[model samples]
Target: MLDLTTGAVLWCALTGLLFTGLWLWYDRRDHARLAALRHRATFHCIRCGNLYAAPRAEEPAPCPKCGHENTRLKF
Candidate 1:
């Protein structure tokens, strides 16, 4: 019957939509994590000899232990 076929099509469409949404959500989460990792900059503290990381590469990062501001390390 036409009604039975319509129900089957509707079910398939909903299932496809659910899967697509999940895939997009996971992909976006992974990309954000990768971007955060790439943006991190390393810093070394002279007062306490602590090594740390900051969100940006150019900005100076304050040491967590000694509160001394340090510039990002060069290669």
Candidate 2:
């Protein structure tokens, strides 16, 4: 019952809508994951003022902030 020209247009529209929805969903999910990671406890170097977060409590780590060779205690 549908004309060939109409069918082609419909198919293109549906495909475009599907791709747009997928892209939005992916972007939102990625943003959520980054937000959660930022909530973790990270330390900043007093000398260089760099931000560093460790997975676990360990020895001193170098300050990525100022490129200092010394490790600062993480709280």
Candidate 3:
């Protein structure tokens, strides 16, 4: 009993809503993972040999010991 125009509009609206929900979910999950990574401590500066903490493997945290830019070091 639905008209073509109405059906198209409804379908578009539903698709938009579905995409929005998916985006929100993905963002939330990503934020949670980043938060967890931030709390972890695992990095060191090769130049100064100073130890530092970073949340993730790609973070660019500096060393507090020698004031040098640090890279992530695996423990």
Candidate 4:
């Protein structure tokens, strides 16, 4: 038979571990999603040399600084 205080401590430790594991899982998932988005949407302006992001790899990634319609280069 477990003591009352020991049981309470065990419950608290289990809850804390559960929450921490959940947080880490969420954080890793978000990081992967963000990384994929970053790799897809990355671009650089040819005119002003400014880096920017676009929704898709289509043409005319407009530069916010110089207003240039930059095209995405194929790798």
Candidate 1 lDDT over residue span 8-69, tens digit each:
99999999999999999999999988998899988889788899998885578889898898
Q: Name the lDDT value of residue 37 in candidate 1.
A: 85
Residue 14 lDDT, candidate 1, scale 0-100: 100
- The weakest ten consecutive residues by lDDT in model 4 span 35-44
Position 65, candidate 1: lDDT: 92
| Candidate 2 lDDT by residue in tens digits, 30-75 | 9988876755455667776677764333335556566554443444
Model 1 worst lDDT run, 10 consecutive residues: 53-62
TM-score ranking from best candidate downward: 1, 3, 4, 2
> Where does candidate 4 stray beyond 4 Å?
39-75
| Runs of candidate 2 exceeding 4 Å displacement | 38-75
Q: What are the per-residue Cα lDDT tens digits for candidate 4 across 8-73?
A: 999999999999999999999999889857755666898889987776745577888998888766
Candidate 2 displacement at residue 29 in angstroms: 0.4
CA lDDT of each prediction against the hidden true structure: 0.89, 0.69, 0.78, 0.83
Which 10 consecutive positions of candidate 2 have the poorest summed lDDT?
A: 54-63
Better candidate number, 2 or 4, judged by lDDT: 4
TM-score quality measure for candidate 4: 0.53
Candidate 2: deviation at residue 8, Å?
A: 0.5
Clashes of 2: 1
For candidate 1, give the lDDT: 0.89
